[model samples]
Target: MAKLTKTFIDKVEPPAEGYAIHWDDKLPGYGLRVTANGVRSFVAQGRVSGKAIITTIGRYGLFTEEAARKKAQKILQDMREGIDPRAVNKADAAMKVTLQDVLEAYVGRPGKLKASTAAEYRRQVEKTFAKWAPLPIASITRDMVKERHAALVKGGLEGKKAAPASANAAFVTLRILIRFAMDEYRQADGTPLIRDNPVDALKHHWAKLGTRTERYIDRRKIGEVWNKLHAMRGEVQGYEALASVDLTIFGLLTGARRDEMATLTWDRVHMDDHDPAECWWHITDRKRGEDLQMPLSSQAVALLRSRPRLKLADGTESPFVFPSWGKSGRIQDARAPMQAIGEIAGRHLSLHDLRRTFTNIAMRECLIEKFRTDLLTGHKPASDDVTSRSYLNLTRLNEWLTGEVQKIGDWIEQQAAIAASKNVVPLQRSA
Candidate 1:
């Protein structure tokens, strides 16, 4: 046992290390401490009713022997009244877990997650943690999740892309992650990694997407707008030649998400053939099946041919099929082209709407076979089961989808031009 004094600290410097001592020569308990790389923490021990009680006083330099002694004395007093300092710390920590770190950890896990999924996780973390980061994660109560959720629901109504579906998705992923963290905390055998997960109690309460919100572009309007966007491909200033146009065309044609198209490679694509037997895009990271190769229409192949050669990040010549403007990874965004098209065509449209438009056309007009459409859109099959999803595939009718998308872009451009030339009546409808 060492004595506490400024002299003791002066002699302590990492390699030599810090030390602790019992308050008295034989005080029914002891003071314990350890130091590494100059950081230190300590705990004091005392016994009540023959049972021991240990209280961690905090870190070195932060708590001096005098301060630790005072704290220990206080704990001694509490123990005399039957209070356990260790139990108190456990209770206190259970109320201190916060939202920010948990969200970051959840998203940063090492795995090849889906493009839309990665995007979704990132978006939810950014949006939810911004407000709650300051709040202790454990302090986050069921009431808080509800309040935040309600605000988001209302915000969805007034949100930039007000879709209850999107709002519910954000909330659902957040709640699930937090709830998982809770169970993790309970069995924690370490330094109390997590106290409690605030969102666990409310898992069954999230508002359902379809029942809570319904919004999408109409099929005919979708066709009209998509054709216009397709025609405007690869021509805008910020958009690179083949990279930009080819990527959007793939998304429109295959009903793949933008990021999926951005990362698409030749290996994933079988443009040569995709009958009911052969596949077009054998997307490795898609949602439905482990691997799917939909048929490639002549439309999709033409777009692929237009893509310029690219070198992957490793300097290997990439048959990226749709090479990135950056030469590797994926395009930061396919939005620039969509924005340009909307501006030129004078219609306020989004790239994702093109995808939704495709889903609408397929469901309403059988634009593609039902099973084929589900696979293409990454949607669960009609039965939506594992076996049903196994049949999902990415058909290659790129040339047709692109041509159709171009036509849609052309129509939108014409509409925009008309609106510019003539005072087009604002089409307003009740939501």
Candidate 2:
């Protein structure tokens, strides 16, 4: 075999199928490998513990012939000593790996992260940690983390101070990433690449950020907000616009999340069940990663009944309750209409605020028990008592929940009527 050279490697032809290897006569166990797919790589072939082994050095254009020979010589020497150079190279690569590399692996692993979670992680990494993407994972120090954390809170990089909540979120994301890397990556000696997570420093000494209070309409103002939302139906023109009004109201009535209401499908809405007790909305997938069957309130059922069924050109009805021509194929956001409704209410509101309003009204006005309120809102039970839960029948529990929710709905209607009367003035003012 001719000694592998740049000129020889350039002229070598790949086999029609499979792969071909040309060994160098001058350098034992050093060779060039060519594949049918037009790949040309330098390789080292040797025996370790009496078993034949072949290890790729690198591609031709990337590694010069002399460099490849030198690498091959080292690899062959290692093999003779019963040490695998590939393992050593892998350990070295692990030490030199970047945060971006670990993130891709962490998110790409099967069942490790949900699509929404993966998307959020990608956003934070790309937007917040762009500068740190290329830094070696092993080289990340506690001081570096503290500096980044301080920089994020001070808004030094972005030119304006960020919200403490936003800064906290970035720090939390980094903590999770570094923790994941520590668990997954290892050094040549099989020890964890990260000894102690630098994020621990922040957790220990940094002044903890307080949780932001959830914004919800006050109990006394629920009537005014409900009446304003009902009036908005007339001001809005299209079916989708009207649907947004209904969706906002439904959010208040049922305490469902924005996506849950927006993405509700017909099949999940069991409106015509023979048993009123059995009538419920089945959320097949929820954020907490479980199926939730929430019994519909009387007002909720009426709202769903009023929605228009959209049909395609083929005469097939659309699956989504709040169908839209938008890219998501459903009513994704109702920010504009919600903003208008909030203005009328005299307080800024969000879709989530509606859910909070439901909970507040149920607890304070309706006098519903906390456990039942939690159940109605699709929150996990605080009491983990197996005996209490076992004795409870789901149908009976739903029946009780439906009654409680109906009380809130009825109260809101009464308030709406009172609010309407205030809008009316006696005609005797002309006298």
Candidate 3:
């Protein structure tokens, strides 16, 4: 062993296998280690409470010999005082676990979270708790949660609406994340880093959301929205804008969820312009995990037939029906188009509102059976009886769905024709 100098370190040869350590003649338990791959690092070796431990000070290039020796002395001194450097490092890492880290862990497991569900959870955390993301999960206090929840309800944020429903939804997502952290991260004594969930403080203060308000478009104004959308479809400039028009109409016609309809591929959509009866769309990512083969109305078929496959920069075609320039290569947001239609129809309307209109027309107008309507909308059956499970599902209802959806389609067309002859009546936008 020799005193480790810069010249000596640079001249040291790496071993052919494993590693070689040259103990410093000047400082006990301090040495330079060279691995087979020529990685040279300074290390401190000492006994901590009877067990021998070695800790790396740093790599040769990053830490000079003099600086490495200083770090080694400090590490050796800490070991003598019964403090294990490994334990200290572990605790430091645990302390730095942030709220964003917890969210990543929560959504990263295979098959635990669906793609759509994961995307929604990420959006909620990124947009709602953006300030709290980088802060350690353990630092989130009950008071902070309560204040943020109230702020969300009051619409204190710049672009957010003062809706208690969205506030409650944000907290629900936070509670899920904190609970996941309680099980995932732990301290020295094996206890969880998070002892109690801060969101639990809002036990009785959660908002009471309702569906009793005007959640759907008025049946009388359906034709007006339909006509306005078609007119806008012709005037829109880009592919994405035009897609917004068709996607909104498709949402109204099929009552499918936004993600389900947005991610539709040409492979999943089977259509025949010659025969409307042969046209149908298949959805594998239903919210309930059920596979559905939904029949398309003549209106839906025409819309799909008109859409051209989006050509990529490389001359290949995109798989999505509604392709966009965004990273996902699919139509993500149609709220702007929906909002414009809402103005003409007399109120603000969401895609879900269009879904409600479809259900309303099917049940209240055509007098279709509730079970058949449920099938068309992909709702779980109220009855779990053997016969309902065995014989009465999507497979058996193909013809019935075709006829029922066609009737709704016919009703919407008739409304459009009648609305053309009368003066349009506009309504106030809801606050």
RMSD of 1: 8.0
The alpha-carbon RMSD values of the candidates against the true structure, listed in the order shown, are 8.0, 6.6, 5.5
Top-lDDT candidate index: 3
Off by over 4 Å in 1: 1-42, 47-55, 77-98, 108-120, 123-135, 138-217, 239-246, 273-279, 309-328, 336-356, 367-369, 375-431
lDDT of every predicted structure (CA atoms): 0.57, 0.78, 0.83
- On residues 291-375, what C-alpha lDDT tens digit does candidate 1 reach at each position? 5444444556666656666665577866566555463445645555565555544444455655765565555655445655555
Mind giving the per-residue lDDT tens digits that candidate 3 earns over 73-172?
9889999998788876666677789989988999999989889889878988887899999999999999999889888887735546555756887899
lDDT of 3: 0.83
Better of 1 and 2 by lDDT: 2
Count: clashes, candidate 2: 0
- Superior candidate under lDDT, 2 versus 3: 3
> How high is each candidate's TM-score?
0.61, 0.69, 0.75
List where candidate 2 sits over 4 angstroms from the true fold: 6-29, 34-40, 45-53, 61-64, 70-182, 185-214, 237-243, 272-279, 286-292, 311-315, 337-350, 395-398, 423-431
Worst 10 residues of 2 by lDDT: 205-214
1 versus 2: better TM-score goes to: 2
Q: What ordering of candidates by TM-score runs from best to worst?
A: 3, 2, 1
